[model samples]
Target: MSLTISELQALFFGLFGGLALFLYGMRKMTEALKATAGSRLKNLLAALTRNRFTGLAAGTVITALIQSSSITSVLVVGFITAGLLSFSQAIGVIIGANVGTTVTAQIIAFNIAEYALLLIALGFLLEVAGRREWLRHYGMVLMGLGFIFFGMELMSEATRPLRDYPPFIDLLRQTRHPLIGILAGALFTTLVQSSSATTGIVIVLSGQGFISLDAGIALIFGANVGTCVTAMLSAIGRPREALKAAVAHVLFNLGGVLLWVWFIPNFAQFISSLSPAHPRVDGCSAAGRRNASADRQRAYFFNIGNALLFIGFTPQLARLVDWLVPARAELDQPVQPKYLDPYFLSDPTVALDQVRLELLHLGQRTLAMVEEGLNAVTRGGRQRLNELRKQDEAIDTLHGEIVTYLGRLSLQNLVEPQPRQIYEYLAVGSYLENIGDVVETNWVTDGFKRLESGVNISTSTLRLLERLHEQVCRSGKITLEALEHNDLEQAREVLRSKATYNELAEQARTHLARRLVVVAPSRLDAFRIEMDLIDHFKRIHTLFRRIARLIEVSVSDSRKTSKSG
Candidate 1:
């Protein structure tokens, strides 16, 4: 018997519509989970990954909570690019992400379609009526869960009529060939961009006795391979470290699938033994609760086995990935924002973190310029001053880029503290830019004027100036370090050293003031240049102090928020 036109319409609409609901629900659930977790997830990954085992555990917990291995992989890539996580450490996380994704299969395996509507109704009520934001987030989670099960129910019903259709049954029988099943599963998952969807569909088919246990096992294995595409796509145009991480994901998944492809029957039988037996119904032994259980057990065993096999060889895997994805030389080019990935803009927490990293990069560049400014002024000629000016230009360019990036970020739906944080980052960027301007416009011009006037500073006065310059540079370095690490203590140190810097500036001024009475050619000019340099150093130190205060406020706010939560 063949499916009639009316029956075919029902099948097509039911399957496609159900899939749409499933995918939408997964997306909503992931989004809600991410919102609830927020920056804490980033902090967790940073804090927990002391070694490969801890990193694996972090990866598993994070992926299980978010319900998306792709998000976990992207986070790993971001951390690697930010230099927060090493490539070797990220390899373990990547492996554990695969293991974590099996949780979705386990979830869908529970026979709860009958209650999906109830869940949807309750979740809707809570989402609309809840008084707290977290409550709303949980409501969304419940709604998403309901949609997933309801979708599975629709898919199951859609396929029920196919049981009597000989041609469709013949097509499904071809999946009993492991290679074909793997190809089919991989291709479908790659197109849909959700291995969970493919897994859900395979479970639905098994529940209706449309595919054998071996076929379902092979398809699940293919899902492990197909899901790597998300990581690969995210790595496009990203740093070499990100590319290496994505490559590691592909190697681990594909290698595991190849290792286990030939043993599908044994894998299925083994998982079947682990799963509870379900009685045959309508002459289909695989048509009851055991169908989903067996499929989920297979996924669990496969991913866990792969993780165990690969965890010991992370160093080797990292080396192999490094070899495959070699670093690009242009990645070291100056004046470009390294951490401001547009992909992160969708998640404001991540986007803000990227901004913070970029600010650190900006601070480092500005600090180098400050260190070189004094050298260009006192010892070097016009060419050296011009080189220092070019450094200022780079600083200006980067500051502008940061401002523009922040502008874009402001357009996002920012939550509490993010708006304030953006303003603080903007202030810091402006202060750093002002420091560059002082060096370029005032200090460098004074150097040029002093060079043209044939005025030379006495060795003692130069030494005093150099000491003040050294103190300013020290403060700048400390401030940048504080910003990089978010260390409140370092920010406080910069704030506390303000009086010392002021005293040094006063001593430099008095020393330059004394030189005004000396009788020498261009003596007055020398006094003026030295005095101006002292004032510029003081101004730069003041700017550094301003940045330190901003860091202090930002860090304090973060601690308060963490505590409140």
Candidate 2:
């Protein structure tokens, strides 16, 4: 078991150097894929539904592309918190994430270590000299693949000496005990913060003749259990719904591990049957053949374990999580965007979705503020007037946050239509804020000033203003609806209704002017009050028109981009 200082240094170099390279490769590959496919992935995730099968498929696709279940789980938690996904649907995606993660093990099992240098050279040439964007991204992927295999090869060589080391052999034997093996797997994955890395390392060890099939399967079980740590840490301080999603992830993995712990022997036997030459058999002569079988068996073991857990426990797990985490009481909560998760900003498409949701919330809040201001004007309630003014502060805060977040997203080299979409969101946010200011500053303050001047609006003038208020409220609702649904037809309707609204305002103004002439000379200030209020309503209408127009332009851009793409 004794080793020279040089030997110890080599071991450390091989293990740590290979691990660092592997992690770096994984990150680069995932980031490149995400940059290339960000929008498609965003759309797929955004379209997640209550159907378990659909969620499962979406989860698998996303995780497979990104090469990290942790990222997928973080996304699922954020979506759940934002109300984009239900607890039940998130469970299916989680299952798919587990299944998708197994793809890494499968890829590693190919044992293409000898070709690593060739891939590295090709990848470097394309990455450094390619003229196209796709060429560079694909080159990055190639480079990452090369680094991964090269690192695995190094680690395999480094650990080969362990086959003869007595102490190391004793430690590998302890892994034959399921509990000991699972604990080792969990502990190592927790430290690495990646199940795939831990699993890959175990496969490398297995291929090097340092671990048996049953021991490898036990370690795989532990890796699954340990990966939950990432999701749990992400959920801290997040919304209650997000916390529940994290809990469900932990629960699902733990339950599956416990259920499968007693059956590792049976599962290992089944995996061996599927292999060309069982690990227990002595007929296999080629080192490559033996290593390939071991690696493939480990991969299959990981995949099948997840498949069975998801298939058998999805329904029960869904129900159990729901019962465990009930919805919070929805009281008279203030109007705000429930789903504006800043974590989504990493993906511009998802971040844009968050902005859209936040803008919708801003619109809803603005509408409420307008309604209260109108009530104050019509009913002359001082308290209601103050409440509307206070609500504007919230509108301002949300507006600023949306703008800042979009600005951050814009800094990233976004894909087609995204830069245009950022401008649209900014325009919509500005318009929404203007509407709030109109209600609080223009309407309420002006009404108070008119009152201080001893001017009381005539009954006829009040009725006209009420009708105009109704029109403005309707316009706000329509604009919000069009934006939320991204309905081109609805946006067109909003555009067409502008003339009708103008006509209505013109008729009301003319009628008000005539009424002003008939008002007593002592009430001359009433004329100014009524006229100013009408002008304010017109300004509000103009802002809504701007929002509706932005919506229209965004939809058009989206169509053009889709066609071109």
Candidate 3:
């Protein structure tokens, strides 16, 4: 009995929809896994740039854990965009990610569908009985995995009709034409959005002896190029560094495909021995490919060979990619995400790096502004207080940015000392944000307000306020340096200055108290403004104290470090 064309189309559509469900389920599972492992991943990844081997391991482990290289690459792109991981470091991570991506293919090659239900039971047990969030995440991952295997089984079963279709065999036979097979493989992977998944399907088909070695290699090569579509798509409008990293990933995979395409027969022959097969005897020619045997070793050999071919060459190719894209034009605005950066929390290690950089920017900018403000207030230099105020606002904006970046980073990076550092930076960023407010509040903002009120201060009061602002500004500079260099001695100097600030403030208060005792009502505005000036003097003390505490924490962490060492 022949299936009608329309009926066949309906069946194909249903299969397509099932494939979609399977892909969607995998996506959901990957996301939940990442979310569950978010804190650990963030902390681990946050400190990633310590070395290349570490970075590669990080990429591999994340991809292995997440079971998705596409996700891994997306996370890498995010880090690069945020200035967390540099291009050189990211290249290593991608290498690890390539290794990790092999996990999916390996899983599918296991033919685990018969026991997929077993994991589902374990998944249910963990979901109900487990207390740890990670166990729950693991449960979800297992359940999703069970479903993945189950879905693949159903998909393979559904496609078995092709075995009976002569026309289908004829079409598959045309896969001998490398160009046709390449396009088919690429289109198939692009349609699926998962090179690993699509390639897994091809591997399974090859195992079943439904396709030839030539066709299998073609599909694998096509899948390599096709995988880049995801990286390229995710990286659009990202920073040049991110774009370059994504492009680097694309180039490496594509380069492997190009290199292997020339030597496909040799590769197949070299590998085909591991899964030794009887030559094809059936009219459809199934005998040589499957041999009705499972050869895990062959599968492993394929992965190792492909990985080395790409990773081995990636270092040199990366430089070529960098040259190709180059840097964007100067004066080009940085990429500012409308929402919180997806990549920021996607990899906490990278996000933490970004926050640190932003903080460094804040430290430098605020330090400069505070110094300028000090000169203006103390030395009667042209009142650049307004300029300083604007710089402070820029600092505030950066703080807000860093805070936003950290907030996302914290969600994923909730591990110990690093999380605490993230917290410290968050607070420091907030404080820096407030420094802008402080600059404007006491001096530039309200200073103009006091001047507008037509209140004239005596020379002594003006000189006193000037000295107070100077001391506070100097303390601000020292605290920034102390925090940056982790210098306990420099930090202690802040405490040393505090007593002096308090003494001068007390003297001003005492002198003002005496004047108030003799002053008449006509000097009321003068008295109020003088008090306002005195209030700022006391606030200088408050600001320095806050900065001192932050520095002390850094110093305390250092002592812990020294003792541990």
Candidate 4:
């Protein structure tokens, strides 16, 4: 039968509307699930195994809970890119992801569309009016589940008219050929960018008696291959390991499809034989019964195929994928924050650990700046002075990066100890940045000015300044060590030594003023410069001491928290 323009528009409207609700509900459900188990999930992902079976199990459980294989694969790619997972370990996760996606198909097959509206109403009330945050999140999960079924209901109703439509019947006939059905499945999945959606649609059509078991099976096979698109897209601009993960996903699906393509009819027969509730293929069965049978059979077959292919070929497949995406030669990049991998941002603990490591690296770089500044002043050379200035700039750049990274970390819901650690890191970074500024702006600039003015410091003054600089440098090194190792005693010692450095500075100043009077009148400029340098060394020591105090406080707080716990 032919339909009017309005009927066609209604069909399109229903189909698109259903798809919109379905996608939105899936997103809501996925996000709520993640938020509910955010920390636990992060820990699980972080603890991925090199063992294929363990990796597979982890991937399956995570993806099944989240209701998205593509998401799982993307996470795997990110972890691999961050050097958190080995290439072989990632292969198993990708393999398991394919199986986990079948959970959606199984859920759809349960045929719970009748309760969709009631779920929506209850979910809406709980989400909008519930007082508790967790209750609201639970309501969102229910709302997502309702939306998914409601959308499917709408699409199923719209497509019912096509049961009598000749053109649509002919298209269903074409899908009986494995190649045509496979292509159709791939195209539909690619358009929606979700294999689950494609599989749901297939179940809908099969229930309506618009498609046969063989065609449905073919479509499912193609959907598996099509789902790889999401992981592949995620790999773009990522590291070499990420690209390998994407390639592994593609290879797994492609290999599975190519291996099973010839057995389409046999697979269909196998599914049909195993489905106890499968309705007769004749046109006598009700659409609901037909769909129920079709849904279960497809879900079962999808699970079986993924399981068999992954389990049997995991080791060989891992090797093949590794060979296909060989590791590239390492690039000679500048020394920067290697552990600041963006992927770890999802796990606050992991992210914080990385940030702490980068901060330690920053501490080392800043110490280098201090050394360079001392050499620049003591040796009286423009080359060392210019290098010192450049190192200071580098330190400044690193400090800015660290501050920005810490700011991003602050946006996350951090645990108790995390906030304290973050604050301590921030304070340390600020102090180091200030120390770099002093070394360049005060020491380098003033020393250069003295050189330009032809004012040479007296030998006695130089010796005194060098001794103080050396002491400050040693203290700075000790403070860094204390911070890095969380050495409470060492930090305390650094704090206690501050008074000694202060007295030394005072004694040096008194001695320098005495020598100035005995020196020639023209040497007054040099004497003043010497005193200024000594004052800067005292200030630098103060900054270093402040860092030590901050470290001590952090350690003390950590101890108290542990005791209370």
Pitting candidate 2 against candidate 4, the one with the higher lDDT is 2
Deviation in Å, model 2, residue 431 alpha carbon: 1.4
* Per-residue lDDT value at 230 in model 3: 71
Ranking by TM-score: 1, 2, 4, 3
Q: TM-score per candidate, in order?
A: 0.92, 0.92, 0.78, 0.78
For residues 1-565, could you state the per-residue lDDT of candidate 2 as single tens digits?
6777888899989988998888877877877777777677757877864588778778888988888776676677667655777777788888788778777887878878999888888889988999877788888888889888888888888876666787887777888899998999999988988887887798778777777777888888888778788778877776666667778778867877888889888877777777777655211123423655655556445555665657556678778877877778899965456666656666666667778888998899998888777668656767777877779988998888887788788887576668878888898999999999888888888768665776667677678788888888888889899998898877787778778778878887898778766847546677776778889989998898888888888888878878976
Best by lDDT: 1
Q: lDDT per model, in order?
A: 0.86, 0.78, 0.66, 0.77
| Cα lDDT tens digits for candidate 1, 192-222 | 9999999999889888877888888888877
Which pairs of residues collide in model 3?
39-412, 42-348, 45-349, 46-349
Q: Largest TM-score belongs to which candidate?
A: 1
For candidate 3, report its TM-score: 0.78
Runs with alpha carbons beyond 4 Å of true place in candidate 2: 45-50, 74-85, 128-131, 281-289, 302-306, 309-313, 326-337, 407-413, 519-522
RMSD of 2: 2.9
**lDDT ranking from best to worst?**
1, 2, 4, 3
